[model samples]
Target chain A: MPTPILVVDDSVMARKMLIKALPAGWDVEITQAGNGVEALAAYRAGKAEVMFLDLTMPELDGYGVLETLQAEGLNSFVIVVSADIQPLARERVKQLGALAFVKKPVDPAQIEAILREYGIAL
Target chain B: MNDQLLLTPDQRDALQEVTNIAMGQAGAQLAQILEVFVQLSVPRINITESSSIATSILQLVGTPQSVTAVRQAFSGTLRGEAMVVYDQNGCRDLADLMGYEDDIDRDSERELLLDVGNVLVGACLNGIAELLGAKLSFSAPTIMAEDVEVGRLINPQQLTWNYALLVEVHFTLEVRDFTCHLMTLMPEESIVALKSALDAFMENL
Candidate 1:
């Protein structure tokens, strides 16, 4: 089975854009969680090698989810996704061990670049 | 300070013109992102005391039992507040257009609100900044329900003026069958500068 990647965000629009941006033939199952709480539960249930997490949420936001994952010592390949292009959010997420940062209105080219950089064949 | 000093008649006219162009650009940006045609009427401008702004803006967005509003502040030669208000139901409709699944929870709602706010407000500010030949920065958008009193939310002290120039923009999302509005408020001083800038640009052309 290909790596199980988790997609975390509250917005359906954001998730749709993420799916569209993913390279074709990734050969992976994408599971989605609406908020940090759901994402934390998803992480605890199974190991997802990769996650695309949104930063701002009402319950267990992106940062909270990252912290939860870290506390459990799960070393998933995580990426921080947000519409707020503030550098502070980026630096904070990077410190939390997110593998990458993707801005919304997700561009296919950027997704491809991240995939290439991470050496994931999709 | 006399609040009237903040804007001359020419300045008011210039700000109106700028807002007209800005709304058009915002409409175009939305259409491009949604991959559908959008129709946005030229915005109407008014200068009124700050006390009445919230009621006026709310009326334009329509009376919904629940509304989700996104606000961002920008500063430059012109400093002001910009808000995009939509019915929460409208947001879900937008989510559907963006391809979100049928079920959307609270967390997803927040994310959707942020994305919606980002694109719409970002595009609006970007257009205005470009037109004014200035750089703009925005704080993270906060989403609130209809119960939130918008007028009270705007700090009177921050305004430093008794009156504000309000720009009301009405727009339609063709695919989604929803209408939204963007309201922009700026200090009288900013209006003065904008007018001078517009007049200068016009003379140059």
Candidate 2:
């Protein structure tokens, strides 16, 4: 069975960039959410095993999603992708149980490396 | 101004670090959108009377006969107004680089100004908010003035605060010979919240 991946961000441009960065020939189904509320809904529906989350959005944000996931004990792997590249941001996301943090404008190599580190085979 | 000294060295340093990262992100986004290399200045942070913002901006960009400016206000956990200013020549040069025809008119120039403002100001504020772990919403960009002194563009009476915390950064496009300034003005009430937010961010680090 293909792995299910959820990409969440308020920016259409950012979401498209994340999708384009996925490794070639990866057998995965991709789901996209424009904000954290949608992301949580998708998560609840078992639509994603992995998520790429952005920190700032309209409704719930990346941190809110992480908090919700932790409160509910959801075990989905999360990799935060955001333009906010401050050291504090990285630390907070790590503390929130994110698998990794990647800065924006998304780099395909970085995404591949992160997926590899998480043992997601290309 | 005594109020300018409200931030301790450590707090100022932390704010500067956040501003630098935000400016970098904004520059990267602008570069991608315009297909040009954007050179950014070190961000400068200052607290001053709200009335002095225009004077400070003039000191940085010099007094020009005509200029184009865009302002957007943001509110949420952090609240501020961000403005982008460019001299007439700078705006013309930028429009040319963006593929505007040789005879660009006032309407086209205004459109160009707002488009750049939306990209740069929006990204920079979002970057800052992200760093502080706050969410912000921005008003639509408004063209404040054209063909006027930079200092005269802002109306003191309209500002909601007596004191302002200013985060300023400059961007230069060498290839296009265009330069512009971005200024974010956080009110005194907002600065209190910002300072606490900075402290929290630093403690976590």
User: In terms of TM-score, which candidate is strongest?
Assistant: 2
Q: State in Å the error of residue A107, model 2.
A: 14
TM-score of chain A of each: 0.93, 0.97
Per-residue lDDT, model 1, residue B192, is 68
Where model 2 places Cα greater than 4 Å from the true spot, the runs are A1-122, B1-5, B63-65
**Window of ten residues with lowest summed lDDT in model 1 chain B:** B144-153
Q: A22-118 in candidate 1: lDDT tens per residue?
A: 8887888889987789888887777467888877555778888878777778578897877535455567788888888886546788878897898
Which tens-of-lDDT digit does each residue in B1-205 have in candidate 2?
Answer: 5554488777786776677668878887777767776765656887878778667666667654567789898999978889898887888788888888888898888988999998888888888789889999999998988777777777778888888888888888758768888888888778889989888876765
Clashing pairs in 1: A10-B107, A10-B108
The pairs that clash in candidate 2 are: none
Q: Residue A49 of candidate 2: its Cα lDDT?
A: 94
Per-candidate DockQ values are: 0.01, 0.05
Error of 2 at A51 (Å): 34
Candidate 1 lDDT by residue in tens digits, B1-205: 3554455554454454455446555666676666665655445667667777666665565553456677777776777877777764677787777777888777786787677667777776676667667677777777644435444445555556766766777667656666666777777777666666656644543
Best candidate per lDDT, number? 2
